[model samples]
Target: MSSGIALARLMFVVLGLVFIATASLRARPQSDVLIMRNGDRLTCEIKRLERGVLYASFDYVDGTVSINWAKVARVESRQLFIVQAEDGSVYEGALRTEEAPGKAPVRIEVLHPAQPARVFEQGRVVELHQTAESFWKRVSGNFDSGLIYTKGNDTTQYNLGVGLRLRRERWNGEVGFNSTLSKTAGVSASTRNESWVQAERLVGRKRWFYAGAARFLESAQQGINLQTTLGGGAGRYVKDSNSARFSVLAGLAYQKTQYEPASGSQNPPNAMAGLFAGNLQLFRFKKTALELSASALPVLTEAGRVRTYVNSSYSIQIVANLWFKISFYGNWDNRPPATFSGSDYGTSSNVSWTFH
Candidate 1:
């Protein structure tokens, strides 16, 4: 068989195995209970708690429903979970709420099978996720795509983005891919592609982390056939709350570039650089979300040369697990190969779907 065919078959087999494993892990009794501050009660399977929203699934509901975490007064669940507190403390166990008297503050309880139960005030708990034996059960991701065509100019543009995240008790992993293509009747096609994988581990319990990442990029506008980067650094969260998060990192990176032959490059192919980056996220419950990230790399081996990247996205929830998103990306290099552009930037609008 051709190598392409064999690769496709292998991918299918791997995906099938993952599906089976996830299905088995998700086969749990829908016996979890929630009590609301206004005395409303629900019996459903809890999915996760993120950004001040609690997600749950009911047998009669067509799709998952989101609840305001602040409005919840009590919870009971038998399934295991990994929970994070506002102070960055991590816990693993089943969940319950302590029964309190009228007008008293609610307290959450984490019940471990072997260890003593841990309790915290409801307001102190920040995040929660159901845990299972299968790795697939700890994975979440989203996909986005956009296309635009203009008949008068015979112009067409396409965009695609995919992201995956794996969450563990004290570590996390992420993978991302993005591509853009543009074609016009009488103009050369423009294309750009980017992919990256990153892993992060929590340090001492104060929102500090260490991370490592590898990134690859190709840009027609910049005359880059490919550029690769490997970097590692330590970072800390400047702000961590239900509504927003901000973090900054500083580290070192090594990068190599392969320029298009047409550019007649004279610069060196490799460089060592200092990396500085920051990321911010803001959420408005199920209504809207915003993300911004920026990175700057100052070349150590090549004097007076620096590279930068900026990305921003805004998403509005359209319905359950679906959103309308607008995104902007910009890449810049202070110095470049002869006759090549020093910067590339673009904007896109997409429909996105997320799953866990």
Candidate 2:
């Protein structure tokens, strides 16, 4: 009977310890705080800031909420984050807003435990990414697919695109694949495929970067079996902001082309070219986004020969990470093998999904 009483007392002690531990965890403060221009305040966990939107999670809320960056008045967070500015400067640290009088421009302070603190204008900050323990959490990508059918000609067409990006403190990498196939009654099928890999490294505390890329293409319409290009160059951002970004690059490239037998070029020639390219991106909060890219390759080995490429896309968010996209692509070569077409252009509408 005495041993039973001792066991009961021990059990009571264990229960008390568990209760104290649980209560301590529940009382811990939230990780971040946000203030709105309308005088509202929120205590929540900030996920990231991208494309003029700040994503956050609240304990009382059901899911992640997106707030417009322009509407934010202040923010404070102790969690480490990767912040990027319009001038191509990047910082990693905790974030806080400076106290300012009415009508004054907002400023953000980045405080690092081991490094000196830095300050930047709030409007000049373009992106923020939370530093996660898992590497996969730092990756983001999108996949899009489209289909078209016509009963009159018994024609069908399908297109698919996939892209993946990995961003780090000073560099980023991207991979992309796109394909289109079409079939029609009493007509031969046609196909086009393109794949590319690109990498960029930040140069300094300004809007400068170095980029390298490799691309492969196959097009039945252009009578090309395969075309491969390798290039590297330096680029600068002309404009970088929440609503728009524009950049240009100039480089040198080498291209090797293999023509189909019917094109009558048994021995295909390789050429070295000068590359000029530009990219533009525009965003409208959560509503819409547009991207445009163009490149020109002037063959140095063969004078007067040129190749050009153009790609443009407009996307409207339907809900959350799902979007409706309309895209156009064009490829042109001023000179081609005998009997081969010199251009291929097409348009597609697709449904796309994005994830981070």
Candidate 3:
């Protein structure tokens, strides 16, 4: 066979794999079905509802269940959308537009721009949605898992994640779980688990630009000592780097950590704060691109009296599906008193394995 013909066949094989993967990622169980407004019932799993489109998963024998949000007068669901807190707690109720003031730390009420704005002298009211308990049941078990390894230090880590999204017409509210484990020599093997969720509004003609993500992170670290933190970040992206538009993002996070030695109770909470440096990427070349970013998180206590450190990272993409990343990390422990000797740096390179 000619080299040209062989190359064509290879491309076809890759493309076929890609399509199969996409289909699998989107496929759902046959039992999923949703009924829309106008008394019309459909047989499909709702993929996602964004803008006016209600994406669904349907099978031949199961029938079709798809509905547009605008056309949806009301939803008939054996399931609904609900929000779960980072504490592994679940809240079951209906979405409401008005929440009583000065009652809860997180006040959730449905967003209303048309409702006359009113100021409460008592407290603040945050918009939130109300849904049924079963909503959480239907969307359960959609989780992801993976493992990552570092060759230089022979370090390996595993991760598990669960994600959820709440759709309004053009906007979505999301939340989920993220947990990880790492093992290496010299460094005490550790595991960190974080649960976070975010909300973003779709903007632009094609809804390609995800305005931003308001994410929360609640994590615990285990090793010789156990430590935990509650933190979060907000991120946004600009679409179409080839154009004049350069997307930039800024974020801030705070964490309270307590360390408990195996034999004793937890230590007092220490403050950890992070600041968004910046990110810029230009995708001009078909197979090449340039991206730069820097973010720093520092232990926010007095340098000498309190254990402190700053973690930072930077990365650049050299070729299609390939990139290099560098991370700088440091930490201090005050218990030993004035022992400032501690810092580390690491780098990683990733290559794409595009089976699809």
Candidate 4:
């Protein structure tokens, strides 16, 4: 036992050292210098600036750090970057900073261009993604977990969620998971599991052709044991910028489902339905990002049944790599299997960690 303990401690030390040596975002073979307002300088790789934060990765013990973009006094780097301004101007060049005397606003200079250095205010520059980052560094997402317990009702619930998004030159892909399990003494355990994957190819700049698959398994009042669906659709982005995005999607879906009636009466335990589905999604990036999505599916046949779901959440950055999210979900089935309500809704809050 003592030998085993000693080996575990040695392994832990090795892992700690590895973590301290490597940063979350891989660095290219160039050193980027960043000057802070307090006259501090860091020889780190400037990863990207998004949502009012500048991310830097260094080969030191601190790994990666997020700096308020406004706190950066100046930066000098020869690496190419994709810079986007709030007024929709884009530049592909290296960046240098100019601080004029007195209270004049600092200006960002676009280098290597034939024209004289184009200068802009700090806040006007909304996005900067380094071209030196590898393909994988362009991907981003987050994971969330939630829990709820009721003493009087003797019930406890748990939730787990994860999402990943990847954007290539002209293509984008997203994968997401949302799962929940609930337990109560002297009663059946309830579980809801959902997973979805979507792929999109950009048409022009703001439009996309997309296809996806979804699998769902749910229990409790709604009473669906399994559901598998395939869908294809087109989408349009009304507003697409670094700080926020708004999009709409319309699609056709084919689904097969198996369910036990909520009232325990046999009302066709299986179903095959063709549906017209659509959704509207909005995302904002800030210290507190607000996300909203709503979807609806109407049965093609004369069954006159419809399914609608709405989700809204606010995510607040709490600390390094962590966020607190308060979310609400509502699902409706116009026509349930048998003797079930037409609605299911819940509100929850979670602390989520993010990695890119």
Candidate 5:
């Protein structure tokens, strides 16, 4: 089974390469150019500039490469782009770069005719996206997993995770899933499963209508076999800069739970709860990404309990689009169901091939 799963992951990589090739072949032409430090001049379509890297697709090359912006001596493009800076300012226009001697940061020149030329250091440029993006261009995400086996105890473990997102001018949608399982000879097996779907619609520059539903099933922790949450509310983007974003959200949440040992288990609460959530996302774009997030739900009924989730992750690129990821997860219950603990936490590392 492990071998089969590994093979499947390999197939995914192969298919991802094929898709990139096809897309590059079909990409619309643009007046974009990138000059590398090695004196290589590439005539390509600059799909986006994010974090500290530039994503470019070449008509001649079969696959796209993420170029470290620092390694790029200059870029000339006439294609319209939505550029965002670390200061939360945004512009729509082409980009020009003035090379600096040695490793000094290149001066980025934003050519906005209506507005004067805005100059910034390379690091201050948070994100750039082609304004001509299509419906498909707004889609991106990734999935990955890792497996382990122990011969001494005849034990095996595996963790899997996946995420997908679609973004447009007015709204965005995201879906995610994660699961972990372990088994040992003569020992009861344990498993955890989680999934969520979320959507947000822009109401202003930094405010949005937000909603999501999530479900979790865990047999080893809290003796919980299942828990589901559904809610909706508003979100405020505290920081909407190019390099990072921070958001806070609040509203109402409804929760239902089913504990393990179903026959005689303590029935968990089904209550209307006040929910609060926040998240911080940072993209180095060069090769690293970081995310920190949490959710809290306080029950108002006799339950007198609070449920919370905290998650953190860091990822670094290992190859073209394959990234090595380390993630930490925490589940907490101020008042747990009978036979359950108050909290559970763990970490996992895996490799994933991400796509956009």
Candidate 6:
């Protein structure tokens, strides 16, 4: 046999093996529920192949669907689950554990396969999350938004603010800033301004969540008031929904209000201790969310008396990475300006940009 002919045969053999390898990695048809490496399961209507990833519409508790996608993790039979190995081999069975479960090796049971059962070597199987995390952050910023509203007196002011956030875990602490401004004209004079630095940490693994924060506010003529608050609550996933977080929280907040009159007069310090309760939610369509809360001020001061307030907001996603947050807020007190009531509402839309 000629040397050139032998080389050509070898090349054909190599090409055949490559074809088999590529065909083996093809994605299977869609399924009802997809369980991720992070132990989160999503129930969605698997749409169609857009680019290369599987697009899905997640079912929400409130009869809505939000678009999402499956990470590039290995998937298996409709009845059984399997994860693929870097060496072109598959570990079949229920996904025993995440790719890297801290100190233990991930295990899988074939049950009916040729090998019957196998425990995956952490070194051989690539952790799907490691790559998915980085890839998602690159593209996730394309969508985000919310709505807020506030009201005081017969004259109500409306303000709106919206922004995007980067979330790590399925639930974790996120930092984002938003500002809203609005004015109301009525029998009584009114102006509203609200902005805050939002930070929240997920403390519970299961739905019993805990979070705390310090909010700094500079409202219309209200000067600067800082409030320190801590709270905890529980939530549940209704059936296979992805957008509703039904929760209730009760917490203590201490607020200090300072004001300097435009007439060059200094007002005495005003401090108030109060309790707040409300429901937190992520609404349907992945565009709207709401929180309805009330605060009670029982203690009285010389410069201030007992008062009660209600704060509620609705956030709407207008476009990719931008949203309009509107708040309906109100305040009522016994102090006589004789029938002192105020209501304020406003909307703000924020858009985000990323620089590589």
Each model's lDDT comes to: 0.87, 0.84, 0.37, 0.67, 0.73, 0.38
> Model 3 over residues 1-356: C-alpha lDDT tens digits?
63223333433443443344344443335443443335576655544332233445466634223344434333322333332221211222322223335433323332234443222111121111333233332231223445678789998876544445544434555555444457886887654433444555534423132433332222223221323334444444443322112334444445444333342434345555544434554432223334554444544553433433333333343432233433333343444312222222222233322111
Question: For model 6, what is the alpha-carbon lDDT of residue 71?
Answer: 37
Alpha-carbon runs more than 4 Å astray in model 2: 1-30, 59-63
The candidate that wins on lDDT is: 1
- The best candidate by TM-score is 1
Q: How many residue pairs clash in each candidate at the backbone level?
A: 0, 0, 10, 0, 0, 36
Cα lDDT of model 5 overall?
0.73
Ranking by TM-score, best first?
1, 2, 5, 4, 6, 3
**Model 6 over residues 1-356: C-alpha lDDT tens digits?**
63223333433443343334334332233354555556677654433221122334443533223233233232333333333333334333433333544545434333334555655543343212111224222111121233334444333333333223333333333222333434354443333433233344434323344455444343443322322223233333221123333344445455554332342323324544444445545454435666565655543343455545566666665543234555555544444222222223333343332110
Task: Rank by lDDT, highest first.
Answer: 1, 2, 5, 4, 6, 3
Following a full C-alpha superposition, what root-mean-square deviation does model 6 have from the true structure? 19.2
TM-score of each: 0.92, 0.88, 0.35, 0.71, 0.76, 0.44
Candidate 1 worst ten-residue window by lDDT: 2-11
Residue 328 in candidate 3, Cα distance off native in Å: 14
Q: Write the per-residue lDDT of candidate 5 for residues 233-317, one digit (tens) a residue.
A: 7877777554678889999888887665543545445878898999998986556889999989888663668889998999988
**Candidate 5 displacement at residue 115 in angstroms:** 13
Give per-residue CA lDDT, model 1, range 235-277, as digits (tens): 9888777888889999999999988878889999999999999
Clashing pairs in 3: 18-356, 42-65, 43-64, 43-65, 80-135, 94-130, 95-130, 109-127, 109-128, 175-197
Inter-residue clash pairs, candidate 5 = none
* Cα-lDDT of candidate 6: 0.38
TM-score of decoy 4: 0.71
Instruction: Please give the TM-score that candidate 1 achieves against the real structure.
Output: 0.92
Tell me how many residue pairs clash in candidate 6.
Answer: 36
Distance (Å) between predicted and true CA of 282, model 6? 5.9
